[model samples]
Target: MSSIASQSRSGPRRGRPRDPKTRRRILAAASALLNEGGIGAVTMEAIAERAGVGKPTVYRQWPNAPAVAMAAFLESTRPLAPAARGGRVLEALRIHLRKVAETFATRAGRNTALMIAAAQNDSELAKVFRNHFIMKSREIGRTLLDRAIASRQLRSDLDIEAALDLLYAPLYFRLLIGHGPLDAHFTDAIIDAALGGLKRRRRT
Candidate 1:
């Protein structure tokens, strides 16, 4: 090896090095506690203990319980599979909605429930939740919808905003209102009804 090659191999590396799975374990620990007992249960000390890491480790990643909960909540609801190009939009929509349903039905659901209630009274948390969760989720849905519209799979003139609301609002409604089930059958119904309206009409 040349002198320059040796020097290139030895220069200081950038950013915090990935610890393989330590950080994931910490986030997992944080999420576990948050899911099981809500925000009150997710302390830095408890997270460190559960993750089998030092307090400094947990603190190094997240400053507070809310921060951890926010990260975990976002992670739990992250898009499962974004629709591929030239793929079936309806199936992709169903897959994404199914994950939403699953998350709302799980322990992380506990954290979401508290966030919803607290958001009503706590302005700051509400803003954080809206920015991180609501906005991000919609962006995901919009990507799928945009692809369909671009490919002429759906009508070009459709109202994307109202269409998005119709696609996702019902799931949240079921979660908060307890009016009905958020099952696969329900998911199918949502997919069909929403797509039915968006589909481009065939010329006679």
Candidate 2:
């Protein structure tokens, strides 16, 4: 018999079972609140009311409002896969940027911006944002950079930290400035300009 069958026959299941549906409902309620009134709108009481659960339930799951907001933000803005792999690092970077642009163009984008502003004043929120969001983006960039280095597509001497900044700083600038909408063409340009220097080749 399968392990599941064996466990069933042995006795009742053990350990704390996770209710995925309940979690999804909570996240959905949080998202709706954020969409309606930004981060400030996502109170434990509000989420409980929206999700048809008690305030204690929301509090039990997440310690604070920022924690819940961070969870909701992550749920809404889960990063997409690299555009291409195995070859064409530049192409992959471009695709990734385009996806980011699209994400920032929606209601989630506004909430993200507000959350960032709030995080500026809240150290705990700042930590959550860095750990949950910024670090993930850095990890993806680092992986791509590592692959490029191994392939001799980019210079081994390049600083991965600085390289990540060069690639992402412009995107943040554009978003914060409201300069223009993030688009394929804009991302393509950023990739082209950045790869020109980072790429392992002599310009002549």
Candidate 3:
């Protein structure tokens, strides 16, 4: 023949040896490990063992424990999307509050608090947490406020930034401080108080 029978594979396949299911398992394992044992416990060795993957696999995916932990944490604590129905801003706000309250009342919340404390010491972790959680919350709240404005439910002249802070800061404080339960009634009361002061009054 043409001396072309000696073709050989050059490198590893373009895809990883493991499939998506294995990757998901690794992420899930990392999340559970962090939740149960905090960031300190998310070593590559431990994550590999927990995930039933090799250490090389973990390292190949994440450069460091913080990166893996961040990914896992974000995966575990993913927030629900804001509802899309029209004319239900207040109701949506209430639902959001209740959901956040429930989150604050869970073991996952405790783990998140620990992550916050850890972030105080780790700048990278802090950046990751802010980007994944804090900024996302701000975006969601801003969208809600913008929608309300577009619908004329809120005053056209209302300062949306200030309004979002006023409406959400109290709830965040409540969540962090454990000052009170974040129930629907509490959310309704907060919405009522905020709307009374923020909404445009009708012409006489």
Please list all clashing residue pairs in model 3, or write none if there are none: none
Scored by lDDT, model 1 comes in at: 0.70
Cα lDDT, model 2, residue 32: 87
Best by TM-score: 2
Candidate 3 clash total? 0
- What is the alpha-carbon lDDT for the whole of candidate 2? 0.71
Model 1: residues >4 Å from true position, as ranges? Answer: 1-25, 52-63, 83-86, 119-121, 202-204
Query: Pick by lDDT: which candidate is best?
Result: 2
**Candidate 2 per-residue lDDT over residues 36-121, each given as its tens digit:** 88877888888989998877666556666656766777667767558555688756766777777777667867577667775676
Report the error of model 1 at residue 60, Å.
5.4
lDDT of all the models against the reference?
0.70, 0.71, 0.67
Quote each prediction's TM-score. Answer: 0.71, 0.80, 0.74
Candidate 1 residue lDDT tens string, 1-204: 222212122221344543637767876888888867787788888888998988766555555556666666665565555556457875676777777777777767646666667657555555655665666777888888888898788899989999889988888778777677767778778889888788999899
Tens-place lDDT digits, model 3, residues 101-174? 56655665656656666557666556666666666766776777777778877788888788778766776677
List the candidate 2 regions with Cα displacement exceeding 4 Å: 1-18, 83-86
Q: Is candidate 1 or candidate 2 better by lDDT?
A: 2
